[model samples]
Target: MAHLLFRLRHVTEEEAAEVRALLDEQGFDVYETQAGFFRLGVDAIWLADTRQREAAEAALDTYQQARLARERDAFEQARARGEAPTLWKRFLAHPVQVALTLVAVVVIALLTLLPFLGLATP
Candidate 1:
């Protein structure tokens, strides 16, 4: 059948499972593919048939929005309970993510500075 149409990134295995359950519940044929090679996959890729594209998209969008709302509510509840999350907890929890973020920041700064340094003026 038609698979490998669309995908998502940065979602955990549990999240992917939840999304798969949701899609199945909505009667959409869906599956996941490995998006990267390493200790951890980059993310899960959700696939659907070409014929199911429109409905699949709508369901995924709704599910993601609902998940976002749930996360926002959880954050608000944590703040109300005086258990606010720490910045370091958010950023440095994954060493790979932290290192990649630093690299990205450095690359962006260098790119931004190059034009100001007259390296691109002609």
Candidate 2:
């Protein structure tokens, strides 16, 4: 029986390529499924041999941990350098759009809650 190894939803192309390369390098018999027409199918990696599932899972876990650490470090570096966006920065960059979005959000929230609030008041 084939074992699902990884899900591909929201995965970046670089990440997918790295995963494929890692699986191939580890000599695991694997196959991939595409999210076919209308995105109905599962997009995932499957192991052909169930016996190799444990090893493949371990490899993937290790890779994910390292990637997570690397990403966190990069984010921290960017933040330290003031390259990461802050609320003030975003508002400065697009004040009008941000104000309009905030207004729309408040309007939608009020519209959604007004009926419930009215019932509770009585």
Candidate 3:
């Protein structure tokens, strides 16, 4: 029986390719499945041999740790250079969009709280 090894949903193409290459390099017998038109199926990698699960999992864990470290280092470098994205930066980049979003949020919150506030008054 095949065991699910990794989920591909929300994973970037570059990350997926790297994961595929890593699995292949590790000599794991694996297969990939795609979510169909209705998205009912899972998009994932599966290991054909259950006996290799532990080894495959360990390899994946190591790879993930390395990737996480690399991403953190990149973010740290960006922050040091004052290039990392911040809320203020985002608002500056798209002021109108940000203002609209804030308005929508306030409207939603007021609508949600209005009934409760009326109950408190009585």
lDDT scores of the candidates, listed in order = 0.73, 0.96, 0.98
Candidate 1 residues 3-112, lDDT tens each? Answer: 55345675576777787788778887666666456736434444556788878778778888998999899999999996776767667567788888899999999898
Clashes of each: 0, 0, 0
Rank candidates by TM-score, best first. 3, 2, 1
The residue-by-residue lDDT of candidate 2 on 46-81, one tens digit each, is 999999989999999999999999999999999999
Q: Model 2, stretches more than 4 Å misplaced?
A: 94-97, 120-122
Model 1: ten consecutive residues of lowest lDDT: 39-48
Report each candidate's C-alpha RMSD, comma-separated, in the order given: 6.0, 2.0, 1.2
> Which numbered prediction scores highest in lDDT against the true structure?
3
Order candidates by lDDT, high to low.
Answer: 3, 2, 1
